[model samples]
Target: MLLMGVERFPTTADPHGEPAPGHTDWPRLPFVPGLMSRLDLAYKRVGYEVLSVAEPDRRAVMLHSDAAVHSSTTRIVHALSHGTPAADLSRSPAAAGQEHVHMVPACATLGTGTDVSQWVRIAHQQAQPTLFVIDLCRAGRSARLSELTRVPDGELNAWVIAATSPDRPAYDGRFSEAVAEVLEQIADHGLDTSPSIRFVRWDRVTRAIQNSLEGLGSSQRIHTTRVDVSQELPELPFFPNPRWRPGTRLEKLHDVVPPVRAFVADLGAEHFMDRVDDHFVGRQSQLHWLAAWLDDDRVGGLRVVTGAPGSGKSALLGALVCSGHEAVIDAAPDIRAYLSAQSPEGVCSPNPLLAAIHSRGRDIDAVMTSIALQWRLPSEPERRWSVADLISEAGTLPAVPALVFDALDEAEDPDDLMKSLLIPLAGAVRPDGRSLVRLLVGTRRWPAGPLLTLAGRDGGLLDLDDVPVEEIRSDLRSHMLRRLSSLPQYIPPEQRPIRTALAETVAEALTEETDRMHEWGPFLVARIFGHVLATQPVPDNVDAAVARGRTVPRSLPDVLELDLDRRPDGKDLRAVLAAVAFAKGDGFPTEAVAAVAPEFAPTPNVAAGCSLARATDQDLLQHVRGLLDAGSFYLRTGVETDGSTLYRLFHQGLADYLQAHPYPLDSATRSEAI
Candidate 1:
């Protein structure tokens, strides 16, 4: 991760100090800000420590050392390991800078007017054989990479990997970024996925780097050479090779507890097609800002993210929470987990704080006991499990935990949540005297009055709808293609094999519709896949289909009406859906729903216009299940503590729709309300 910044910097000086002539500040220059840190992050992402390194203002600073060290390291050799400990030595900065010391045909390209012999001498001084990846300009005037530096006989041979042979400029993190990706790719695939070679040998890294360029969308080619009998690098992994076990990395894996794993896995990224073609595409700036904010020593509190339906709010939050992803976003160092009321898998609870705590593998019963003991809830033992009680308990947590509350507006008790869980959690204090929690909540803007009180001045609001639409268009396009490509592998080859041409057509149409209509979201794309797939003779007119699809009303009343049209007994389906949609807490008990649903006296010839002799609750339920499976409606079904299946819709939009357009129920419902 060490970056030897080659750029010039401005070092402020008193005009009378007579800095390098009119050059106030020595034309002072240092490494790129965050560049070295990013490279370190790259290796750390793969569970390696490249050691002490970089950003201009970061931990490692390469001050204006003498140029003499470039060609001759005898006097000023201490520059290499100044800030960094002896155990950690950098490989990139020096490598990239080495090119500047080489000879060109007539004149050197940006050289210090010295040969690379000094650098060669320094390479042999490393504690272990080092892998030196030099960034050499491939411009027509440059010499061959191998010719630039020659090692003296009897010295230890170091591995040299060169980003050369083709013309290219070394910009911010160019070679470093590509190198990071290459190592990560190799690590992910494991040595078995690669061609047979010694896993820890230089040959493996060389081949993998070259092969990785294609996947990285890079034209840069890297060449490698081994000077002699170099030792192996234990960092290279081989899944099948039992003999080559990863050290320290295994301990790191165990440190990530099961509860932590569950919390992250539940995030959308670890599941579905998200792991493959994740399209959190346009929110890098937001993510980076969030990462910096989260990791900032000066700030710690709630970060609220809101968006209209289909704005990809959940996906963005999920990316930040999932494992391996935290590094990409530079999240807080100690993120226990991220919990959302509206998990992509539809797993939720009425008491989200409780759910989140339990998701982290914390003992909810114990947490409740501790809170009850400390704060004294009502005399009744059962009342201690309430949202406020749990929130109080969260404040006494062992660590500065992070909790992500997604879709608060979708909570069964938004007001109760605001008063008990959210407000308290927002201002909670940890047992150790630190803040109670680091929270990121995603929800729609609603019941604005209460939310505003919680927001205060420190709160942040990121409205997905407020973001530039072009960015969302790109994300949706990528998501659509990824989803399209996943079908064949996910669906058994024996059934409904997708033709490449058909997939391309559908993807193009879906992307265009989502982008053109500005309606691309996870839900919309999923529904498109379902509806379009059902159509026979996959239509060639993608745009026309997309146009027709958008015409499917988004408004609740219109949507309910459209869903009703899908079945023959539209009235029965609609009534059942209305009951389920309006049920409280994901959905009240089935018996409760039946009590409120419209009922009719038994008719002798009920089979006359309808298929069923009489519409039993089971019949209506079967129809409801079809609607749920069709994506026309969004509902979650979970078992209650009493063992009955509770069905409710997590979508606040649908609930709003159901409220405005209540079914024409003939049942005695005024007294049967939940």
Candidate 2:
């Protein structure tokens, strides 16, 4: 790592009485030292050897008093670009045997002194993987740096993250500060591991920096440029997470579990798990059955859990993984006992008891790769492993490995997944005449074919539709009470009792509504009532709150419609929702929402209405944040592949709702619509 910065410029040099004509006497950046310190600390924490150009010898060469003999910036750029060994400017001596060099230069844009072209020149000479974190004004214009450094048809050696766009000036020291902050966060908290590896990539770092700057309300938009040489550079393991211990089974499992799965599990826990006491409530019978299936070696095969769209299938699967095998088995007594117990802490299972995967938007290769990783089997370079290979490998292990697949219907090719993977794995057996692996699956529906027939023959189908209505209602009530008890701290103490009573009234009203509408399950009823109670104005007394609760729409769609109608910025919020609804994969960043929001203009003449078409990017971002904060129940937030926050509908039902009621204006005709 090469860290360099110029806080201030000297007034005079030997031949040039003044510095270059365009160079400003740049103000002293007080935060430079702190930035360098933070970066050094973070890099060292993740086991990187750091070398700073601020060291005595390099500092003299960087800011030499005699510019007439040799320009300080010229020498610095030459040393960086060519690594002159004779002049003692080579970084290779310090970074000997290192495959990658990370260069962080925080300095002013002093004409040729800190011109991006000078930095781009480094990419041309360095053949090894190089990352340049350029924190300078108009750094976004340095997009060509990656292009200049590109190795055609090979692994990209150069990666660049610029502080701001070409048209905008970076705030003094703010970009560096944001970078330092993101580094510290990644070091301390650690990011979700990639599907194959546990390293932080350049894209992840760039997104983290962007999110950090946005969170701090800085106008600087971070830009990143990189080329994947043979798809290697994109997946290149740039930094080892401080938390990861190389070659550990636990770490391997963590690597295999997709970030989307973790995000969904978290989202499910928030809605279904007891928040007040941090306990998992309800689903005792199902939990007991699952526990028995896992414990019983004789009954080894595939077990399927089927339910309606909003019937808590994902929540149940999430509970299984989050609770772990032992916890779920122990918590099977009843809801009361479950509520009293401590919630499961970490998701990493020591033993290969449960290896789960979520199939949402994932292809067969990804699914197979995850399975291979979890099983600790030798991975092929081409990721050409088959279900037969997985089954064959499972026979080698002493203990029967349980594999869990959730949301199979959402896979890229559901039929292929079923026919090729799940069905074959379901019937797989060992030479000793025992099942090689235990399979657990959760889905809304299954194709009526061999797989379904096998499940039926084995009596492995656990239809949540069979779960009694009263039991579901009981769970819903418990969830509601827990959610209500954990009210925002901002609520006044004097109004606490009233709010508590109001929550109870709302819960009871929602339960009654569910009873009236038998089709509405725990997820649907809870989500609707939760949104209603969260968004509605808090009443002074229980009576008014109860009346408000009674006024909630009976049907889920009607409830969503009413909520949208109630918002003054309904159109803008709808636009955000549409973006989220249509987003592919896990979710999309706020930037994507802002980019597409303009097409959904507000209807004219609506009182106090504002159209997103006229909103600036910053304003759109703020509006999205406001919506997230206010209607958290309606939308879910997840971490994208690039380590940025992503927004999506809370449930598939919401997506269905949005699809049913499409935004009328087409993008081509949007201008006239506005």
Candidate 3:
């Protein structure tokens, strides 16, 4: 085991003008922030003290300690021999306007009183075309015992670099282990004499590895598994002000004045008719504002629409997509007039457009399949990028080609799927120049990390409140009417009164000057419908069902509380809630769930239901009703491969709610309480 150490180069800030000798402010360095933590851990593991040597002299920034002076001196000689200047190396600034600073490679050192034979073995190991790890915590640098193998401490010093930044921290143990393994392999293979290890610059390591992989073939090239070092930073909380201040965003809910009403309606919930008429009933003026923004030819770029869950962000995105799509298609004639003339108005008849959309992933794959069905592309010799293939296989005219990624945060594997895959695909432009692509995404504010990054990088953010309440309300009304008419139970007597009462409630609630009504759309549409439906007089069990249902609870908030309260024994109900709320694929099966909560498995007959089948059936019904109007949990149920019915949650919000308001854990506590 070769030893390694780090000399913390403390930079002295300038008392006058120039920085004091060895002075450095580390965070500003973009790469340094990400690199510092790793190197620090590596040096610490190798058992040595890291010292800052930032002197102007060529030998500045040397690993200094009482032990292993020969190794340290040898490292300096190696640097001098390499003709590498002894100036402090600086990294690019991470944040704008931050000062740049210098950072040296991590310098390793040896400890006192090591076994001579062991030192020689490790030293000879280092002399090979191998990575010498100085585990400062456990051991020091070992001197080579043999005349044939001379390990320069300077060579080891030149190998390591200071960790990135303290702010952008990283973990160690495994990372060290990985590095150690690679080093050990290099020594065992006698790679030093054969290929002659080329210690490339630390920064060029990745490129060197890649080239080597290609040259040596995959089997021979060691794929350096870079640890996910980004995890060290403390996770920033979602909200700055954790206290849920009542009525902050609520005022927009009502704003009966034309401007207010239009903005409220944009939230996509016409079900809250009372609020609509009272605060935002007939505000048509805001549509003109949106129309003007949409019609602007100069604003031809990606745009983002964002808001809280009930804020009508999705509705606005749909409306925008519909508006610009035609214009975009119409503009394509300028790129290729002949192609446009050959294709029908709705047909995707452009090769470039087809290629752009077919770049990657299942979502796009489904979109392509639908296109293939519509275009009636021939099943003969399958065409790749031919014009006929484009016409026949392509679905609709991808005019304006607005790739609207609705509810990005809702997507499974958001980081890898959205950030890495979908987003990059959407940003690509067709080389043929027939159509323009724009990406618009909508998501709730809670998990807005990637979305926020997208906005900052490529688009502008649009708050839902920016849209007029009246327009939103009008759209809501139309949507509600359509939905109500579609539902079999909501016809005639039920529709008329429910519609009337809903309208009145919305108007009254929204018109009140004291009430902030803009944010009420999602809640009113979803929650109110859920409550009313649960309370409805069903033909099967009007009295008995009503009695049981009434006991179950009526409101959205109350219903959630009831479900949580219904847990028989408080065996980590919070865990149960979390497990159910964030099930991997919508929901988990009873058996799968039992794995998450094994204690409940033995008493499945009583705790869940009679049998697994009965429990699953009942759970499905509960899930359906439970998800109907709630903002958080959405129910998904189906039988699994194990012949057991499974259920899952649709949103992360339910898990968040559970974590925030958790119940007591375990059988002992429940028994004691009983």
Best prediction by TM-score: 2
The order by descending TM-score is 2, 1, 3
Instruction: Give the Å shift of residue 391 in candidate 3.
Output: 22
> What lDDT would each prediction earn against the true structure?
0.42, 0.57, 0.34
Off by over 4 Å in 1: 1-299, 310-398, 411-413, 419-421, 428-434, 448-456, 486-536, 541-564, 567-571, 588-613, 617-633, 662-674
**Candidate 1: tens digits of C-alpha lDDT, residues 1-674:** 22343334335566666554322132222333344555555555545544432212221221222222222222211111111101111233344543333311111121232223334344446434333455434321122335433653234434455554434433333455566565554454332221222243445456656665555567666654533335333332211221233443322322332322222332332232223332234455566655555544333477777655555566556555542233211222222223221122221212112222112113344333433433333346445476555655655544344555555565445565556566766776665666666667676666434554465466476766666655654544444445444554424443233333344333344345544333334344434343344433433344544544344343234434554555455555455556666665335654555555453212325553442225464454343444344433344444333223456653445566566555533334422321
Model 2 agreement with the true structure over 419-524: per-residue lDDT tens digits? 8888888888887888877888877664525555678788888877677667765665666556555656316676666655655555566556444444444456
- For this target, which candidate reaches the highest lDDT against the unseen true structure? 2
- The candidates, ranked best first by lDDT, are 2, 1, 3
Clashing pairs in 1: 9-28, 9-29, 11-25, 428-436, 586-648, 587-647
173-193 per-residue lDDT for model 3 (tens digits)? 222333433223223321111
Question: Which residue runs of candidate 3 sit more than 4 Å off their true CA positions?
Answer: 1-300, 312-401, 410-436, 446-460, 470-490, 493-498, 506-528, 537-579, 585-587, 594-633, 637-646, 650-655, 658-674
Which residue runs of candidate 2 sit more than 4 Å off their true CA positions? 1-256, 263-280, 325-351, 446-453, 488-518, 535-549, 604-607, 616-622, 625-631, 664-674
Q: What is candidate 1's CA lDDT for residue 437?
A: 62
Q: RMSD in Å for candidate 1, one decimal? A: 26.1
